[model samples]
Target: MEKTPSACAMQWNIELERDLRSKKPGKSIEAILDIGPRLEWWSRESNLHAAEYKIFGLIPGEDKLFANAILLRLADAFKSGDKHMKICIVKIFLSELKQRRQLRGQGRKDEGILSKDKVDSYRELLTRIKIVFDSGNIEERALALVLFGCWAHIAKDSADVRYLILSSLWSMHILEAKASLFAAGCISELADDFAHVFLEMLGGLLVSSETSRTIRLAGGRAFAKMWCPILLADIAHKTGVNLILESSEEEFSLVMLVSLSKIASKWTPLIPRQVELLSSFMTKDRGLSLQVIALKCLRFILTKGMYHFPANSNVTLKLFGVINQLDFPPALHFDALRVLCKILPPNLDTIPCTEILTIFSKFLQIVEFKLQSPVISERVFAIHVLACIFDKLLGILKDRSGIGSIVSSRMLTFTFDRISY
Candidate 1:
């Protein structure tokens, strides 16, 4: 039911950008905290232009306001089972983003907002959202909880608030209210949608043996609380929509992956159960996808436990089956080898030289892809692992294989090679 945007709103946005960014004193990032929600609600009512910017301009700067807008619109969509509203909201955001970029080209400092101020704003906004979770209609509450998880990763103040909200939903069993969302005589198509993501995230963050045990205990304890059973399995599980590829934004995914990887040690044992129950997802073409997820999980496990871990070598070998079974594009192969290089004892598996060269032949793609991080710290992980191989390569080839060693050098000359068809 979203309407088309008026010329005025479009112009207002442009003016707002110009007014805020062109100043010497600078604009308050908190001023427009709620604009994202307002624009979204209006866009869902039918502004095609509003709808476009609703998603486009709104997503990056949304903070708490963005979450509110999403919650409100999702509630509305749930009540009406309206597809147009979803489409409208997304379109508006995208369109707004497109417009913002156009304006940026002409000199506008996008929200000029500092991350700290925005996180502070989101905390207050989260308080308001919790009230909605308890009293706003059930569908609205459920939808709010879903968004809580999505925004939790990005929102600076989001950690504790996100966990509590999701925990409260679990303890309360909001999904059991059974209000039932239906559009075409079917039950609500809306589901937790964010649960799998948070779960995967939780899995990724488990880094240490101590954290691993704690996470399983925490996950089990959390899920074990069952005031109601058949209708659910702790925290409102999204029974309706089959979750597949719902989350894939590059920047966001990377953020979630890295953070979760930090906590991956806690998630390992908890994963088998999640993987087992969600058996339907184990399809044909998805083999590669699953392997990627598994290896990434394993990589996360090693990265976290590497320092303090006592059984580092055994953990590597036990998980070796998972890594070796994985089917990555040749691009990822080198890092897989590099990861192995981190834990592989010089005397155990294959000769260090042959292993280094063999993996270097394959894993250069990982090196090339990972080398682009602008942050000195972020690039360090790859460099450190690649260093292990380079040390061995240098020793073996400094006298024997100088040409081969240069190809594997830090310059990453391999990076410029595009995979042309």
Candidate 2:
């Protein structure tokens, strides 16, 4: 006779219980691997709910067993298991940690807080995981870092636990490790006292000549997330104008530029200066890739600090110059159009109708030209830019019969012509 799905679940549950109860670390690891796949199965298989009741009940409440048996053996499993098995173990840790957090949130102190016996087991597990992080393969080390992050809440109250996590940030240099640590820092909301330390470390990695390109980029991203006014000012002063003018390393400069772009919203005082620097870079015969980045940084600045650039500002004209230049690539053209759209003042009343009309007229002419291009991508890009312009200025343009009628006629002719073809 064939077994029902329920029967299969029951058998696996029995085997899992036996494995969890076993003294050998390998058996406990096998049980953890088994539970990984069945987690979704147990949740979705309504018929197997009764069978799942015991295992679910066993796993969360048996913190001592988990800390001692399962977590202690994870280092070995991470070392020996294939990618799938290693992923399964990490999933199990995350699930259990989540449950512990939920229980603590609900005031179940007895279950959430470890007892004396379980405390020792938990400490041992941390030690073992740290060992894996210190000596394991790249994937293993990354996984270990994730586990440390999940446990960062515990570090809030325990000095030892806090030290272990902070120390791991220095020891792990891989990009993945850095990303994991930064994310964990965000979640843990590291105390202000330690924030500077973390920022300093990330800054060192970003500026260090010895750092690989990938690590440097990751470090830049990390620094952006942890940025504050004081730190930003410090970095800006230290790098000074040399960041744009004298930095011979293109990749490093690009990373710094991109990072600064993200924090534009927070640092309003520097917007005008950055606008001038990036505008100069774009107008020059710089690398196409660098120009694209500079355009994007300008876009971010305009989006965050639009009030700083009046319609007649030199910055606005510089942007127009970028758009009108025939030699620039379509990609730069598209991004410049985006920046222009962002430059439109939120309140139309602040700028005169003629000034706005002049801007729209220029935009409409560009769209009309690009819409007629033989290349499909250029035409598509033109359509997108047209949509963005209309989306931003549609209300203001509607009141101006001359430009509005021109826009309507151009769009209708383009649409019908394409359909007829």
Candidate 3:
């Protein structure tokens, strides 16, 4: 004479409502969940219900405890190798919330407006982890990441935007999905910690080689979005070794690196990290065949001037060392000339033995015939760098012989020929 599990859940929901209305303090989630005899079978559905309750009032507040509780539950699901549970939480709950909002429109007829239950659910989440950030521990860090990932919005004045997002600096996912969502009023919550957890999961995947493809690709896309923007302008830069190592296809590696360069273009300062990562693809990993793509991106990032991308002597010199060892597609040499213009100190062309300028000078004419008109986009890029090199070369025309002479003769003639309308 056992009650069916759904029947029991219905009963518990009734009792829980009674407890909530009575405003009782002793009511505990554990005690309620334990009410069923075969709790294991009912636990999954019950856990979902706990997460979905809307308890918080508007002017939503941060909750650390609830956030932790949710994360712990999710982590447990992951630990148990429960794919259905993981997909349910990540795809159905976390990701699908945003998707629902997209369908619902601002008024939310599609998914319906946030209910009292939904608001309270979020409030509980924020309240639990509220003060732990200042406490300083790995748990706190994890707590911060979860809250940030789950709810922190980037909208400037929205009631939901909890943190000042420097995410455009380091998070690609934020830039692509979150930025647009925040701006359009489509999304008001962000779990900023997804990147950290994702990175942690990725490292685990790298070690175990058993992680799902969904996890790897989604995780990488997430990291690439957030971290890409931050590495620009030379503050605390590091090479993107992940691109070369994680991406099996050389072309995919190139596409990713090129995408990084495109993001770096609007930089508030010079881009040194771009060079470090780009150098990894140079010469040796032709299979990492992104030079043309990377060059196009580099050209765009450097549209303004050589001064835009300030040099890291270490990265630039390493790049030169790599350049010295082998030959590349002549198109790459041309693009390298453009990158060198920005990163090198003003008179780097004067460096003896093997500066970029020397390579260009010794071989500029040699490769001239091979450097065909780039594709329309490529032509646009080459134009941008040509403008930069032309400006700088004009200044030192008297001191620099080969480049200035070639520019005076062949390049200026082309500009005039193309523009005479």
What would the per-residue lDDT of candidate 3 be over residues 1-421, giving only the tens digit for each residue? 3433333444444454454334345443323333322222332222232223333221222222233333334333323322332233333233434544455333434221122232334454343333333342433333333433434332222333334222221233332223322222212122334433333433444334554443334333333333323432122122234544656755445545654564455354435566556655554455325655555555666673424444545445544443343446545655665566565536544444234454344333323332354545545554565556556656766576765676567666665665674
Candidate 1 CA-lDDT value: 0.38
* Global lDDT scores for all candidate models: 0.38, 0.58, 0.41
Off by over 4 Å in 2: 1-125, 133-143, 149-191, 208-214, 227-246, 264-281, 296-315, 321-332, 345-361, 374-421
Model 2: per-residue Cα lDDT over 1-421, one tens digit each: 4333333544565666677567785776678866654443332332323445465443333433433343345545555566666677777757755665565545555432223433445666566666766777677767766766555543344455456556555454674456355544543343444555566565555556676666655655554444355554446424433544656767766776766665554566655556666766675567666776888788776655443554344555566767777777766777776676566545443566666566656666777666766778877776776676666556767677786776667666766876787
Candidate 1 Cα misplacement greater than 4 A, ranges:
1-136, 146-168, 171-260, 264-294, 300-335, 344-421
Best by TM-score: 2
> Please, what are the lDDT tens digits per residue for candidate 1 over residues 19-125?
33444432312213334444533433332233555544544333334333333433333233333332333343344434443554466553222123333454554
What lDDT does candidate 3 reach at residue 249?
A: 55
Each model's number of backbone clashes? 40, 0, 41
| Number of residue pairs clashing in candidate 1, backbone atoms closer than 3 angstroms, sequence gap of 3 or more or interchain | 40
The 10-residue segment of model 2 with minimum total lDDT is 40-49
Better of 2 and 3 by TM-score: 2
Q: Give the TM-score of each candidate.
A: 0.30, 0.56, 0.40
Model 2: how far is 381 from its true place, Å? 7.8
